[model samples]
Target: MFNNIFLLMRQELALSVLVFLLLFIKIGKERSNTSILNFVNIALFVNLIIGICFVGKGELFSGMFATNALIILEKNILNLAVLIISMQSFAWLKNHDQVIEFYLLIFTSLLGMFFLISSGNLLIFYLGLEMSTIPLAAAANFDLSKRKSSEAAMKLILSSAFSSGILLMGISFLYGTSGTLTFSILTAHISNNPLQLFAFILLVSGFAFKIAAVPFHLWTADVYEGAPIAVTSFLSVVSKAAVLFTFVSVLYKVFQPIASTWYLILILLAVVTILIGNLFAIRQDNFKRFLAFSSIAQVGFILIGISGSSVAGSASLIYFILIYVFSNLAAFGVVSLVSALTGKENISDYKGFYKTNPLLSWVLTIALFSLAGVPPTAGFFGKLFLMMAGAAKGNYGLITFAALNMVISFYYYLRVVKAIFMEENEAPIEKLGIPLVSKMAMYICVAGILITGLASMIYDYIYSLSFGL
Candidate 1:
């Protein structure tokens, strides 16, 4: 019984234990100048190492939970994301009284995401989904310094609540029709019944909200502009990646039978998302809001892979997200650091930034260029693979529309680049002094962006992992 529950569930169990351990450390008499964020970073890094060495897969809790190679890989990617976010954020949280509360909120949400990513049963997925969304609300509200923090929290939770209702209703419909919560058996039972079709659309809507897909993305830009940069970064990269993977998993792995229906929906959704995201991005002044729309556009590109409907599509999505993690994090890291030092969050404020902060300027420049799909950046290849995967389906018209949208995206992405390198500022931000840990994290991100593009093996390995290549 111990082995059954503990072996495959090691990461989740260990993370739960760490949260408790953190409680003790927070409350214990020992007090010093040391930051708990630092300690948490170290602990999480160790967790990543342990996860890498963990070999094998199994279902736990009577098959409600699953831990497999793909799940582990996804978890590690998330871990890396959280670690970098934490490291870069120490300066922001160092003096806040709710530092313990901050980390707690993060871990709680992360634990929920772990369950969400690994669950084999619908009930377990819902449980994890709630766990993930709740703490993020609190985290978003952590900054009472500004009224918008509270506003962002309210918007996020309300959206989650509505999505939850839709999702739960859909799950009930599925249960009524299929009579099983286990996904492995779900595909066999699901038919083209109108009831089941409605349930699937409802389920897709719930996930679309989470992934910040177009129609459901009303809350994204405002929340991103209002929330703390660290929280916004977490939402943009980590949360989106998890939702995308889970969306892909359920559709590609479990519900391929209904491909005739949902894939068509995704194509329409993808075109709309790309066009709206890019069009809105052109008008954003707040740097975070710009990134918010940028992320939305990127999601549309990811949809191309999903609509492609092949192992290659799934593999390309995972690979693209890996590249995306490094690129987006690096961009946000620079934003966080600059915001901390100068209290500036507008793109216009970044004028003549290169003269003052070369490292940050270059990192942001490369990151944005990569995001724009410029050659020799991981994002370029990421888009290339996604395009290739989409092309595989012989849908020339859809791919052509996607390609044209990519051109529109380049204009907005380079707008930020133009601010950093070409535009001049009367009062440029001074040379910023980032902490060692933040610098290290930025270096890692920059390196990842470069190497992942220059080396084919990086993409090859990710594709191999997803496809057993």
Candidate 2:
């Protein structure tokens, strides 16, 4: 039984241990921020490796928790994302007074994500969701002296409370209708009943808030702009990826019986999210806020793949998210470094940026190109697969509209590139020194952006794991 628990819940167990280790360190004597950061990074790297090595399939705690290759893979993707974020955050973490506290908050959120992914019961799912979400508000408030940071935390708390209430109401409705919270049992109970459909809508609303889908995305730009860059990266990449994984799982599994109904709903949400995200992205000046909208647009694409509701859809969505982790984090890495050094977060601050910092400028360009879905980058192929999956249902008109939105995305994405390489600033921000750790993280992201798309086997592997989904 212990062995089963160890193997089935290895990812969550390992993360929990890491969290406790950090807590102990915090309880002990004072240490330099650098030492704590290094220790935390090394420990997290080991935890990530552990997550990859032990792959199994089974249920624990009477099916409240479960694990399989695909779930394990999902957790691994998140592990990799958080590690990269930590590496990229070196520039900021080395200086922050409460480095250990920062990491604790991140780990707490991550532990929640692991549980959320492994949850086989709605009770477990809701517990995990709250665990993951509550810590983020604290992380957002980490910049304790900044008014915007406080405001960001306040907004996040309010929004989170609002969403959690809606989610609980939906869960209550679901339990009342189905008489059980177990996913497998719940699926057998689901139908096109008006009350059930309404519950599902409310549930999707809670998820939409997490993924920052349009209508619920009003809080995103402000939160991203106000939070520290590193926190913003976590919110954008790691947090979104975890929720998306669970979102796909819940839709594909628990709600499979209502496929026809949710399919149409996803279509409407995808179109509106893409259109609104692209239009708003074009108008943003703050770089974090710009990427906030960009991430929203990316979620819109993920939704397209999810709407396919097939093995192909599952495979494509996972693959796209893997690519997205690298592409989005690369963009945030640059933002973190620059914002740390110059305290400038506006688009205009990058004018003539390439002339002074050619390498960093190119790195940012490649990342933006990937995000814009430009050719030869992983993002292009990622978007391509998502569209193909979405078209699996013969929704060509929807695909066409999405394709058009991609073009609109290009205008804004390239607008930044053009500023970097072409537009001139009279006094370009001086060539700033890039820290070795941060630069390493950037290189890793760039390689991922370039290699993941080009490597067919990666997608094939994901597709294989998704076979029985």
Give the TM-score of each candidate.
Answer: 0.97, 0.99
RMSD of 1: 1.5
Off by over 4 Å in 1: 30-33, 467-469
Writing each residue's lDDT as its tens digit, candidate 1 over 342-438 gives 7899999999999888889999999998899998888999999999988887999998998999899889888888888898888999888888889
Q: Give the range where candidate 2 is weakest over 10 consecutive residues by summed lDDT.
A: 460-469
List runs of model 2 lying over 4 Å from the truth. 467-469
The digit string of per-residue lDDT tens for model 2 on 1-469 reads: 9989888888888888888888999899989988888888888889889988878899998999988999999999999999999999998888888888898899999999999999999999999999999999999999999999999999998999899999999999999998999999999999999999999999999999999999899999989988999889999998999999999899988898888998998998999999999999999989999999999999999999989988989899999999999999999999899988889889999999999999889889999999999879999999999999999999899999999999999999999999999997998878999988889899999999999999999999999988423
lDDT for model 1 comes to 0.88
Return the top candidate by TM-score. Answer: 2
- Which residue pairs of candidate 2 clash? none
